[model samples]
Target: MQHSVMEEGTAYEPPTYDETFPVLPESASSSSGRLNIFSINNNLQLGRITITQMFRVPGEERKFDHSDKFGERESIRTCKTIMKETNTIIEIATSKDQSLTFLITGKQNQVLEAKRRILTTFQTQASKQISIPKDHHRWILGKQGQRLKDLEKTTATKINVPSVQDQSDTITITGTKEGIEKAEHEIRVISDEQI
Candidate 1:
């Protein structure tokens, strides 16, 4: 048998079988199961977890009264903001009965913080309805509802003005007792100006 010889002062290198076996594609080599295991391990190391929570919105504060033009409800917007601020993920689903279910994912501390903020924001609150002339609704709404939005922001309340089609003069304000009182005062001031 002939013996193979390596050149002196040269390091030995292993032979590669380039064509013997087909190289696996990146995706094939990293199977989803293995990646999932890795992800689980990483999350364990990071103390990440997912939790589900359900909250019942008061009947008086439904989306019809608090949604923006895009139809994103106020609670949804608030959750999204909380998610960003707390470095968490929040998924909101509205039930047929108007309850909100939140799927929150993050580290334990972050998830708890998000939950606390959401609970505080959506806690039991007061609602007040005031009557104004239908004609003055336009003035209270201002151009594209800017005035109404400003009043809500300033008073920390949600104000729902009846749509023109509804033919209702009732305006709904929902928030803390102080907020409702402030908003009521403001709405009355605006309506009185229309006289």
Candidate 2:
């Protein structure tokens, strides 16, 4: 079969890096030596998105209770670093009504990471603490803390059982209400086990 090499007097040419995309600057990486995304594929998702989060501090006096509010305005300012780590930009506006408005924008992954980090960092989260006998701490911790790790993963919580040396009886569970409940229940059950 005889076929023409070119159609419409135009021949196919493979795309060069410069043609397909722009050249990335060498200053992409920070001093910490983190690997930055130099360039993204043309067809790949740049992953841009915007998210808004609203927070209300309890009581109008703004007495600055740790559990009821996002903390003093200065503390909240420190959390901005978390957003920068994820390459997200944020604008926070506060009103006399004791409400805070957060506007975050960035790549999809960046936005999501920043959102979760910011909430867990500044937002008032639920926590539960239980007293487990010092002797039973080993059982809950298991060998090398594997059991505790598993329980934490399942419950989606951070369980802080004081070091065996500290002589502390409190097993503090910090996370969502559901997570705290699950972890607390599981801990009590484990401690009650006869084995």
lDDT of each: 0.70, 0.68
Q: Candidate 1 on 109-146: residue-level lDDT in tens?
A: 67656655654475456788888899999989999999
Which consecutive 10 residues in model 2 have the weakest lDDT in total?
54-63
Worst 10 residues of 1 by lDDT: 31-40
Which residue pairs show backbone clashes in model 2?
47-108
Best by TM-score: 1
Q: What is the lDDT of residue 52 in candidate 1?
A: 47
RMSD of 2: 12.8
> After superposing candidate 2, which stretches have Cα over 4 Å from the reference?
1-124
Per-residue C-alpha lDDT of model 2 across residues 1-195, encoded as one tens digit per residue = 995476786878877855685445665344454556778567855454444433333334233435544546655665567766887787766665666555767775566566555545544568777988888999999999999977876565788989968898889998656558888999999999934
Q: What is the lDDT, from 0 to 100, of the residue 158 in candidate 1?
A: 80
